[model samples]
Target chain A: MAIKVLHHGLATTVQDLGRPGYFHLGIPVGGAMDRYAMRAANLLVGNDEGAAGLEAVFIGPKLEFTEDALVAVTGADMPTKVDGVAQPGWTAFKVKAGQTLTFDFLKSGARICIAVSGGIDVPEALGSRSTYPIGALGGYKGRPLTAGDELPVGKSNLASEGRNVPEALRRRPGPSAELRVLPGLYWHRVTEESQQNFFADEWKVANEADRMGYRFKGGRKLDFVDREQPFGAGSDPSNIVDSCYPYGSIQVPGGTEPIILHRDAVSGGGYFMVGTVISADMDLIGQLQPHSPTRFVKVTMEDALAARRVRQLNLARLREALA
Target chain B: MSARYTFGGDEHLFVECSEEMSLEAFFTSLSMAKGVRESGIKGVTEICPANASLQMKFDPDVIHPNDILKEVKAIEGAAARAEPVLKTRIVEIPVFYNDPWTHETLMRFRERHQDPTGTDLDYAARINGYGAVDDFVGAHSGSPWFVSMVGFVAGLPFMYQMVERQRQIQVPKYLRPRTDTPKLTVGHGGCFGCIYSVRGAGGYQMFGITPMPIFDPTQTTSYLRDFMVFFRPGDIVKFKPIDRDAYDQAVEDVDKGRFAPPIREVSFDLREFQKDIDGCNAMLEGMLNGH
Candidate 1:
């Protein structure tokens, strides 16, 4: 099976769960930012969790399926249409031969994952099929999916095994305001006021935000003696001292604004990691669209763990339901 | 620059577990911790290098944040009392220092530095060179150089922060920060900050080339993800610079399996085409894996 890319949306590219442990090699983990949604979509279409699929940002593309295909779109609740007919989100649908799928303006979230039944058959790079746009490597020719790009589908009958996106899993996303975080690698470095304000304040996603990092505006500016600090934005005049791989919530310099690292964040960073959005809450942050106001909530490690436990149980339930 | 530096307490969490200790002592104490031994944290994770400081990654479900704090407090003394296994191996890296800065580049660096004294300019040029002395010279006459952190990107290792004197003469960043710049340059050939998975434009200064491949996907054991790097927040590094011939010999030895990268470690040194070499290992991984 194959699908012709009629119009590549804002920033569409094929991604999977992303490559980990390679951060030390100067490779960013460029994968589905909203992994939870990506997995759900893959399951909806009877594909494995790590299947290569389209991570369409802003809006999805118009595609023409050459043969019958089963597809599912997850993440955003945008206005998606099939052959000029409104289609529902979070469900599997069969596109007959020569069917055209198009997406309208985004109603929420920055991106969505479109998983076809027989996962995209792109050549693997380092055991993954994610795209790294900056270096022009990986994914559909090492770049975002472009108009007229033809993607071949792996020969598999996985779609015959029907899977469903449970109603609970299909629950509409919550308010884009409050964000949850665990104390960062250097959370204590910020002033108490800054820390308090960080959680209390609402910051708008700056225009500069991208897969590399989400640069936000208006938390609290750091007030420290302008000595050559080693962490954060503009902290070091030279290159950042190799430190640790980013685990999300790496605070770039200028503590005035905080950056929530995303899937494509570099492995090691010099900036002080102000806080990491807990694993359970990371998908929430990932789904946030630009200009969405977000606030940080300091969850104790216990709470973070509890949240993860809930998510784990939820995943188990999802798998059982699919089975 | 040596004005008594008193770190602000409110801003930073400074848990002084020891007044003075060697890398061996620190490692020993950490390796023998109760949490690591009893909590089953060791087997659960890949590499947990116990050094002067044991940076434990907590799974929120298994370990609470407060529990980690309690663990840190309870283990600080244990880490202090413990001793490290001191079986050290010296990995010789090959390097070729390339002068990429033209007159314009030099001028830009000069303009970036607020105080462009001759010494400052010299220091900018020395970024490539100074890293070598700082890592190998024992940080000032037999002073033990501690391994501050083991960074990713072929596991580029960072020894310690620059000395107070070396901090005085530093270069300024160019007008635009290049995110795709490779982590290692002339001096700190084995330094971290190399991107192993993602390739992007960066602005780190480039100087030398190292023949010892820091990373190569063709090697069977190479997995940007599986190879766990060994270095802790406070392990000691004995930096020793090797010339071009030694670098070539090291590469030859590595290729022949005389020095194959361990199942946990990956390393590379860019001694030629400073720009491309920095990202070669990561670029190769991406290309090899179809990332």
Candidate 2:
């Protein structure tokens, strides 16, 4: 079975749960940004949670299936349609051979996840089907999907049509998001007043945000404690001796704009990372749109762990309910 | 002797060896990383060792964060007590100093440079008290460098020279980052030297270009068949200066999938090297040239 692309949309690519165990080699874990929604879409089609699917940003793709398949659309509220008829997201439905599927302009979130009954059958690179375009590895041809591409689909026996996730279980991406952070990798570098301002103020997401990192605007300039620069650290007051950066670490260069490193970010750098967004809030970061107002909420390690436990339990509950 | 361990949320543990970059600190991190990897911890996803620090990612559901921390602490303690003996390789990488491509790029981004009037090499040479850029190049290529870390991008190795501390070269990064850098551009920033793995934005002071590819996702070359990245953390790299003719030929060989960098196997003993850097480097050079 195959799905031929009619329109590739904006920045669409194949993604899964991402490849682990390779970060030591300087490889970024490129995967579906909103993993919660990706898993939900897969579960709706009765596929394994780590199954590969199409992830599109802003605009959505136009695809024509060559064979019968069960499919589900989740994440952003990009109204999907089959043969010009409107269809609801968070549900599995059947598409017959020669049927066309398209999506409307994004109504809520910045990205949408589309899961077919069988996962996108791309050859795995380093044990993952997720695309890392910077390194030119994994996913479809190690790049974004373009027009005239025919993606092969795997065979599935677990999927059935007319399955839907309950409304209460679904998450809607909003215009504003609060990301929880554990503030202290190099938090000591910033002034106490600036640290307080970082959490107190709402920062607007910049247009330059991408898979690597998100740059935020409209924040007070952070001031670093004065000290003689270390041997290898750059001259910038915000720079530290080169160190490892966490997956969701936040760094402000020149103390003006704060950039939050994401899944596909460089593993380490010289900039002083002040805080890291908790794992529970990373999915929310994926859904954040350009120009969206964001606030960094400080949380203790215990609180962060508790939040992670709740997310895991929710996923388990969803799987049980679907079964 | 004590490593500062911090929580990067609940999923990652950041262990810093020292605030300053030193061979001892790097060895400590490498030994600790090896220990953690060999322990076969169930939830450990990644064990990344940086210049003088180590970061580990784990699944909290399968392993408690504190449990991993305790293990890391124990490993660090053991590493501190014992001498680190690492199995390493010495590789000779060919570089063409003041290559046209990087020279042009440096000229284009001169306004973003610390010294806009002169070329990157000239400025670097002047600041380092060398009379000519050639002298600077000679000093840079004089000794083999240790691959202290391999990151910022896949296959991008941050190398530190094996020379004494007083003779080490230091240069600040660009005043502002350049929008484009040619792939394989050999660059220096602060006290570290690096080769750009892919064409992208960079702030490193451009000095030359390497004719060979350090990273190949396709894994077409014989040397890269087993792994896409050419350099590892403990590897030793010597930058052999080459002329335009050799550079072009090497590039052609790489393009035709026949390029193989000069590689030699060697065992690196941290304690011995710390005692006598020049003596150890001479022995390593003999092994490279003897082959």
Candidate 3:
């Protein structure tokens, strides 16, 4: 019924599929950064795909269950142990009362999604259990979990112990990732040579990357076409009149480091957005770790849609197999 | 004017009504957004109308991106032929200018400011060609501002003053953004005024602080019981200058869960406002102040 936290590692919080439909009022669509991994973890534990789960970044928490439960961990290749016994990820296993769960150093990826048999039963705010800590809303008390906080788990009737995701379906973290993007909007604002260089360079994820945005370094300084800035627009050459920033939009302020606005980013801003990471590749961004190299590949709208269809089909197949 | 339609990846459609910030463009965007919402497009998930543009998030699986684009275009075409009548609310917000908290914060981040030697108000007043800070403050509070967009954070409204181009007050943002800003601090940057709903990093020139909470996630206040956010795009806001005594009283009322912003319902005609900006603003201000 409850899980007691012994050690809160790095940043850990409850997240689900996010609260959509309120971006107009400036509420960010906050949720698990790695949607695919979160769904997979929930499926492995016999929970609904959108069930609330714990998303831990950098490090993982040490948790002790008060009642018997089944749990699964997905996304990162974090070395985990149950009651001091090593356990494999991407699979569910039973844990006895008072058994402690902990993780070792991360081998790859930046986040880990842990799904309890029943979802983390936190009060839903704005129709989501996800946390927006800046606004102090949703999740467990609208903030990251701390040591000694007890989280309540929902009731589950399915016998899900020992369920596992196939190795083919498991996503492995890599040193580099290719993100597909549809270039438009303010893409024309950048010089043709700079636009070409943006796709040509292999950028490394900066340490400042987080849920708000992913800043990439080592790319050539992007240059914008010189023009008198319009009224109301800031003096920065990279700034446009304040406009709506789509989720996954990429903007290069000062034409230096390119930042990809993410799940918890500001809904709109004055910066010129050159491109947006397609829905299919957004999951890959969630898996990108600091210092990981990433290449932005321009893809056609048709190809992006095709990739999305394939992703949906794969998710459906996984759900069927688990059922 | 025609709108420039572009795609923001596969999930969003970005519609630019105008290159410059204008009430006519905003009204057009707002009207088209309303049309789209009323049409009940199958896949449309979120509609965000900004200063002079609109961004819509849709599910490609539910409806083809091209189809949504077509529907929005059709809606825009129809909206363009019709006069825009905006149902709006005039909100009177109390602000204590040069309050100690924001003053302390602004002074602390002076190194990030354009003029590191003087306070933000003095710099802003001087740059706007005002002899004294009082004149600048008077000019700012004299006119009502239209909420062009609600973004940058939850419940944060970006406002543009309703005035002639020459009368508009403009100020540049900080040379570098400050790492911290106090919540409820009224700030101005470029040509927009905003109330920091939740304090975080900000680059705007700090001016004053408001006691009324624009955002209450707890919904403890009666005004925020139904909606956690206070302002919506298209709302008119007038910042009323207040003294320390009034500010403290308002703070006390807020602490006691009794403070509510003064608001009145009004219909805004875009064509009328465009014809006479001063007259329209005066009428709106009169309605708000009950003069």
Candidate 4:
């Protein structure tokens, strides 16, 4: 069974956890920015955590199911309705054929994840079903879900009755709060005052936020301490060099504002990385809408690890429950 | 340190522990570990080219992610004590500041300050003594650089300094960002890193163009290193200049090479990318049909 695209509102595309380990190929890990929500929705529908789903940014599309299927919606609060009736969040629903699923304007957060039973059947590209629009390599023709696109779904006889995501596990509000971070690659190069501003002040998301990175409008430009080339530029300053880039890396060029890289960011960059948002807190960053207030909250390494452990334990339990 | 091996799959495995650590330090540690190579992770197709996260694609049939997570944690722990691996090169570029008008327009008071008696010119005078430009640019060769990150184009490594200098250059705001800034031109007013490979729009006040190829596509590995970059953690890199002849020799081959087949015309590909326009109709068919 497949779902017919009635109208793809805003920017909707197929995204999984993401495509990682291919920075060398010039590909960023373009996946669900809020991976937690993605997993939640997937688990609710009994699909594998890595199954392909819709990453509905801003307002979601009006989707019409062509066949009876189990689906769930999570992440970000969009005004969701089925046949004009208000729908709930983070639980699987059996939608009959021809039933229309409509999502109005997003009330909070930037993106929402929709998972269907048997997962969205998109052709895998380079080992992933995630869409990378820039390279046109993955997902539905490597592009955003459009108004007329039809998406296929694989068959699965697994009962949807048991795969429901519990109410306690639903994504709660507070993702718009301060982001936790680790000191960046070149944190020392920045002025002490800049460090204070980074933590203490609320930064506004600049107009330049995209899948690649988020540029913030804030006080203080992180500058290099020395004029000499720091390192990593192979003998010349041309285009190609052997290099690797990390996630949540904040690159500051000559601009006063800083750009924080996200899921679809490039594999390499030539600017100074003043800091990286902590992995545990990166999901919060994914939910930040434009002009959303963001602050960097510094955490010890131990705290970050503990937070990760908590999340891992949660995921492990879900898997064990499925088993 | 063994003969290389390649793993296959579509799963991304990251150290859940990367939250509070230095991204530079994190990758540096990974590069130093052993048995973290391809064989250890059976389903991992490739290691992503990123500093902050270690991405690996794996096939679910071959290896389950939960089983691999245990090994990934071990690799993360092993990375802490490993010596840093360096993926940085200190290449010095020559700049003549050939335009006298540009110099006069930019720094009008420099000639008067050249006198030995002038206190204002003391810094320049000290640097001018005994092949100073050569000596200054050459100073970078001895120091090692850390491969901080990569992107802009493939293999464009951004390195960082572990130490501070006595005098740091201030980057003045660009008076104008040229919409059509030529590629390969280094910006004026600052010694920003070179755009080694020439492909896209540049913002730097381009001083001059070097006649060498910044990136090479012919090599077996498109990216320079497999595990880590050229520079280790906490290393320094200083630039050293190459003469015109050396630069020419390095770039000549790529300049004359023919485009590989399955190579669609650059114009067509660009049009496909800009599909919203009406004139792009010629390319939209390829986009819709999953070409």
Q: Considering every candidate listed, which one attains the maximal TM-score?
A: 3
lDDT (0 to 1) per candidate: 0.55, 0.89, 0.91, 0.55
- Ranking according to DockQ, highest score first: 3, 2, 1, 4
Better of 1 and 3 by TM-score: 3
Residue B283 displacement (Å), model 3: 1.9
- Stretches of model 3 off by over 4 angstroms after superposition: none
Task: Judge candidate 4 at residue B95 and give its lDDT.
Answer: 32
A best-first ranking of the candidates according to their TM-score comes to 3, 2, 1, 4
**Candidate with best lDDT:** 3
Ranking by lDDT: 3, 2, 4, 1
TM-score of each: 0.69, 0.97, 0.98, 0.59
* Tens digit of per-residue lDDT, candidate 4, span B81-180: 4544433223333333222322332243333332323221123324334245344333322232333444444334444322222321213213333334
Cα lDDT tens digits for candidate 2, B1-291:
678888888789999887778788888888888888898788998889888889999999888988988888888878887678878889999999999999989989889998988899998899888999999999999899989888898788999888877788889899999999999999999889999998889999999999888888888866788989988899999999999999999989988878888888899887788799888988999999973
Lowest-lDDT window of 10 residues in candidate 4 chain B? Answer: B1-10
Question: Model 2 chain A: which ten-residue window has the lowest total lDDT?
Answer: A226-235
Give lDDT tens digits, candidate 3, residues B179-248. 9999999999888899999989999999999999999899887789999999999899999999999999
lDDT of 4 at B216: 41
- Candidate by candidate, in order, the iRMS in Å equals 8.8, 1.0, 0.8, 10.0
Who wins the DockQ comparison? Answer: 3
The CAPRI class of candidate 4 is: incorrect
Backbone collisions counted per model: 62, 0, 0, 46
